[model samples]
Target: MRYAYDAQSGQCLKFVYRGYQGNGNGFDSKEECEDQCARSLYDFA
Candidate 1:
């Protein structure tokens, strides 16, 4: 399983990875995706 960040919903969603290609866009877990992308959504100034 793997997670992808949804820019519209601002959340990390999980799905099965059927193939073995590579890119920096995939996240191993919801927490990891949230840490990198969603953090900006919740940050307080």
Candidate 2:
């Protein structure tokens, strides 16, 4: 599975499972996605 989020908003947008076309923001896990968003937020801060 994978996850996607809004970089500016730092919010999780959606998830992408196996065998599906993702939006390219997909992550390995929800935690990873959230972590990425957090990092992005921190970077902006």
Candidate 3:
């Protein structure tokens, strides 16, 4: 799916944001993934 959330809406994950796209927002490289993961939410499965 393009989106998901935890038990609470307080957490969310999206496939597209600020021009990024994937099963969720993806990085150009692994380093970028590591960096963005810090700022992005990924609690949703």
TM-score to true structure, per model: 0.66, 0.56, 0.30
Per residue, candidate 3 scores C-alpha lDDT tens digits across 1-45 of 233433254433444345444354444544455455544555533
Backbone clash pairs for candidate 3 read none
Model 2 RMSD vs true structure: 3.2
**What does candidate 1's lDDT look like per residue over 1-45, in tens digits?**
988888787678987877688566588888898797766666753
Which is superior by lDDT, 1 or 2? 1
lDDT (10s digit) by residue, model 2, range 1-45: 457887676577655477666565778777888887788778978
Name the runs in model 2 displaced over 4 angstroms. Answer: 7-10, 17-24
Ranking by lDDT: 1, 2, 3
True lDDT of residue 19, candidate 3? 47
Could you tell me the C-alpha RMSD of candidate 1 in Å? 3.1
Q: Name every residue pair that clashes in candidate 1.
A: none
What are the runs in model 3 whose C-alpha is more than 4 Å off? Answer: 1-24, 41-45
- Alpha-carbon RMSD, each predicted model: 3.1, 3.2, 9.0
Candidate lDDT (C-alpha), each: 0.78, 0.72, 0.45
